[model samples]
Target: MNQYLISIYQPDGPTPEPEILEPIMRDVEAVNAELREAGAWVFAGGLFPPSTSTVLRLKDSEVLTTDGPYVEGKEHLGGFTVIRAADLDEALAWGEKVARAITLPVEVRPLQHGACQ
Candidate 1:
C-alpha cells in the first residue's frame, strides 16, 4: 500500500468558536478511530497556531531562521493524517472523509516510495 498525506487547510485561521469546533473535533476523532480500526492510520495530529511556526534555511553552511512560515499566504496547514492505501483513489476517499468531518479543504498527496520508512 502507498502512503498518503491528508492535510487540512484553512484560509481564515482555525475555527473561531468552540461551539462550532467541538462537533468537528468529535468527527475528527471518529475518523481517526475508524482509520486505526481499519489499519490505515499511520499518524495523525493537529498543528499549533501559525504564530508558533519558525522557518529555517541553510545556505553555504550558514543557517538562517525566521519567525514565520516560509511563504506569506492566507491559507496554512492546520493538521494532517498519514494513511496507507492501495492507490490514489483510496487515499482520496479517506481525504474526503476528513474534509467532510472538519468542513475544511483537504489536500491528499502520495508520499514518495520508501519515504515513510
Candidate 2:
C-alpha cells in the first residue's frame, strides 16, 4: 500500500459560527470513521490557524525563527489525513469523500517510498 496525504485547505479568516460549522465537523468525523473502518486511516488532525504557525529556516549558518506561515495565502492548510491506498485512484476517491464532507478543496499526493517508515 502507498501512503497519501489528503490536505484540507480553508480560507484565512475567522472561523464560521457554530451553527454553520458543527454539521461540517460531524460530516468530517463520519468520513474519518469510514476511513478507519477500511483500514486506510494512518493519521488525521486539524491544525490551529496560520497565526499560530512558526517558520524556521537556516540563515547565515544560523537558524531563524519567524512567526506565522512560511508564505501568506488566501487559504491555508486547515487539516490533513494520511491514508494508505492501493494507488492514486483510490487515494483520490478518499480525497473526494473528504472534500464533500467539508465542502472545501482537498489535495491528494503520494508519499515517497519508505517515507514515515
Candidate 1 residue-wise lDDT, 1-117, digit = tens: 899999999774646789988998899999999899999999988888788899889989999998978888888898999999999999999999999998989999999999989
Q: For every model shown, what is its TM-score relative to the native structure?
A: 0.93, 0.97
Please list the residue runs of candidate 1 whose C-alpha ends up more than 4 Å from where it truly belongs after superposition.
Answer: none
| Total backbone clashes of candidate 2, pairs 3 or more residues apart or in separate chains | 0
Could you tell me how far off, in angstroms, the CA of residue 76 lies in candidate 1 after the best superposition?
0.5
Tell me, by lDDT, which candidate is best: 2
Considering summed lDDT, which 10 consecutive residues are worst modelled in model 2? 108-117
User: After aligning candidate 1 to the native by TM-score, how far in Å is the CA of 1 from where it should be?
Assistant: 1.1
Clashes of each: 0, 0
RMSD of 1: 1.3
- Candidate 2 regions exceeding 4 Å error are none
Q: Clashes in model 2: which pairs?
A: none
